[model samples]
Target chain A: MIRPLAGMARVGLRFQLAYRSDVIMSVVALVAQVFLLRMIWTALYGGREHDPQGLTLEALLAYLSLANLQAFATTPIIPRIAHFRIRTGMVFFDLSRPTGYLPQMAAFQAGHTAGGLLMLAPAVPVVLLVGTITPTEHPIGYAATLALGYVISVMMSLLICVIGFWTLETAAISMLYRLVSHFFAGTMVPLSFFPGALGVLADALPFKYMGYVPAAVYVGHLSGGQIGQAVAVEVGWIAALAALLWAMWRRAHRRVVIQGG
Target chain B: MAEVVRTLRLYWRLQRAAMRGALQYRLNLVIGVATGVAYQGSGFAFVWVVMHTFPAIGGWSLREIAFLYGLRLTAHALYVLPFSSLIGLDWLVREGELDRVLLRPLNPLVQIMAKRLGVGQLGDLLAGLVLLVVALPPLGPASALFCLAAVVGGALVETAVSLALASLSLRTWNTIAVRVFADDLFSKFGSYPMSVFGGAAQWALTFVLPVAFVAYVPASVLLDRTGELNVPAPVAYASPLLGVALFALAYRIWSRQLRHYQSTGT
Candidate 1:
């Protein structure tokens, strides 16, 4: 199983790397995004400031910049690809395969993300310089949380993509995901800044664990016990999502009506 | 004159067919529209959260910013309504569907423009109108006409920028990322006033990408606060002309790129 997964990952990595233009474009897009965020935050934090929500100006800026950078690197294109395949009737080949569909697709996307992150490495320096941010207190701990965050994010995206099996309206599903995540995922603003009801809603969503928790841990907003709890939540969400995806895949695969060919 | 009439007739026929095909997926269309509403709702929620926390940022109140947001959103909806098919140019080029389009005895670009109707933009249109009504800036006949022209201009600018960026597909054979990058430049920055940005961003939004012309400048004119970003009143009033000029330039570039296109032999 590991061997097949690894092989699939390699194929994904190579396929992604071959699209040199996409790699370059992603880098350029990330840099432009960092600039945009810097402008917005800098303007927001003009002069007289008491750090709202217990965050210093520097910390808020750091989290905003870093969260955006991380989100940019981790955005999975597999759903879009899956949509295209399903629409073109090419998904039939993958569905007919004997391997566990989830593992194969996950490994493939993981590999693509690895390549994508490599291309996105320049964004780190850009963020550090523009945001004037520093390293977290516990580098290893931050890494662990970030890995979990990536897992949950990828799993959630896969769940969204699996909707293609039932309906080729995957773009709408993905757009809905994009729309909700902007508020719920704490990508656009810190979840702490959300008003009472909205704050509660953000906390309840799995998306916060994907972006907010990881950035918060890196920025020292979550420490020790808090970090532990966040990771546990992320893990729990991952498990729940995995089960949901399993059920969805079973149902969606049954309804797959191959078109074109 | 006869050629113009012929093109218009063809566009009308193409639009009807496109609408018919799109209506076939009734559920998807409904979901798409609902998704648009939800999308706009979240964006408005973000603005509400920000303004609620702070009275004003960059010397603009919530209502003022909403005026800006409304103008931009409605302008974008206007663009999406007629020309949303431009977003899918990369796919058409990649799959060689463009070849079949070229075989038709009409302007390939016009056919592309007429191919898909973005019915979902109706939701955005409604949302934008609601915001504009809420902002409720003082409106005289001249200002109202100015506002209407500004929205149309904003739409033209957006369409021009999208077309220009998407035309890269003619050479790269894949320009989805580039097109997305262009779209992001507007949606990300168009919400706020140009004064909020640094000197370089302000300059870019003014002369380079000109999203400032889309909403912020127009809003300033309506709100009676020109030169806030140092844009002259004359240029601010020329938003419609600017949009038309930019679109004309972008279309010229797109036409030139079309000559470079080689079929993928579907």
Candidate 2:
């Protein structure tokens, strides 16, 4: 089991490197995204007369910048893999494997995900460049929380893509998911602008676990207690979702065997 | 002209089929609607958030901005739902499906687009209606007329532009990049008042992207707001002319591209 898993993971690395052009384009796209978000956040910060509820413009900018870079780097791997399998007939060949389907795919994807770290490769320099251009008092305490935030974002994306086990419309699902996540989780802009009661509600949603939490950490916005709870929720979500995903895959596999889908 | 009508009719049939196909998956359809609502809701949420940060954007108040946004979404949905394939034009082109469309009777461009209506449009329309209601205080009867002319007219023009992009798909091997590039650019343009971007950005939006006519013109009148950014009130009243002009151009382009379309072997 270990050897086969290791071999599959190794193959995933080769698969990613072979598509170097795609990797470069993806990195370029992510860089464009970083610049776009930074500009938008700058505009938003410009609008702020005061950081009521304790938001500093620099902290907010750093939060957004880090979250943008981290999400671009760590996530999107599952949707990428799931889309190819469904669009082509590779799922059939994969089922012929002795290994469990999703775990194998996840392991394979973990290797592919390394290429995504290119997004983060430029993040520090750009943030420093951004810092020099406009000083924002970002604290170091935010680092650990931001790390947990990456975990949350990747786990949520995996949970969402696991829906592909049951649904064939992965593109539509993925598009909708990304749109909602970007909006509700403060990926495009901060969620602070949401109305009072609603802002609270938005923060409560798992959607924020994707973008807001990371930004929250980057800006040192989360309290130690809040960080603890956030990590706990993220871990709990991963466990609960992993179980749900396994159950969904089993149900879907039953149908696949019966109908050969 | 006859080809246009025939293409529209074929498009209607394909639209019906697409709707039926969507309806067949009831569970998927329900989730899809929810997803769409969340998707659109996020954009509105972004606007709501931005407004909180700034009292006004370039003299456009929250209600007035909402009015423009409402018009923007309505026009966008009206065009996009009916010509859904515009975004997917590259795929259709690359797959050699455009040749099947070109081989058909009536306008081949119409044949290509007739089947392109996206059902998620219903979500956009409903969302726009709610926004219109919210924005009603700033709007008057004259503004309503402008909104009518602008949104309905704008949808037509936008659809024509989409069709024009589809036409490009025939010649350009990569229509997908165009779709992505265009959509990304317009998403930002559509969300904000074009006037806020300065004269150059505004002009580019009006003549180059054409989104300004869709949202800004009608929104200006409806919001009862005036600035350097507002479209001349007359432009809002006759927005449909823009759509007609674009549609004619798109048709001409499609006809030229069709002569070169070679059918694919599936």
Judged by TM-score, which candidate is best?
A: 1
Worst 10 residues of 2 chain B by lDDT: B221-230
| Chain B structural similarity as TM-score, candidate 1 | 0.95
Best by lDDT: 1
lDDT of 2: 0.66
Each candidate's lDDT (Cα)?
0.82, 0.66
lDDT (tens digit, per residue) of candidate 2 on A125-192: 76545532333234443555555555555566666555666665587777776776666777666666
Candidate 2 Cα misplacement greater than 4 A, ranges: A1-3, A10-48, A79-102, A119-143, A157-176, A191-209, A223-258, B1-22, B50-54, B137-142, B198-203, B230-240, B262-266
Per-residue error (Å), model 2, residue B154: 1.9
Q: What fraction of the true interface does each of the listed models get right, in terms of native contacts kept?
A: 0.67, 0.38
Candidate 2, B-chain TM: 0.86
Model 2: what is its DockQ?
Answer: 0.37
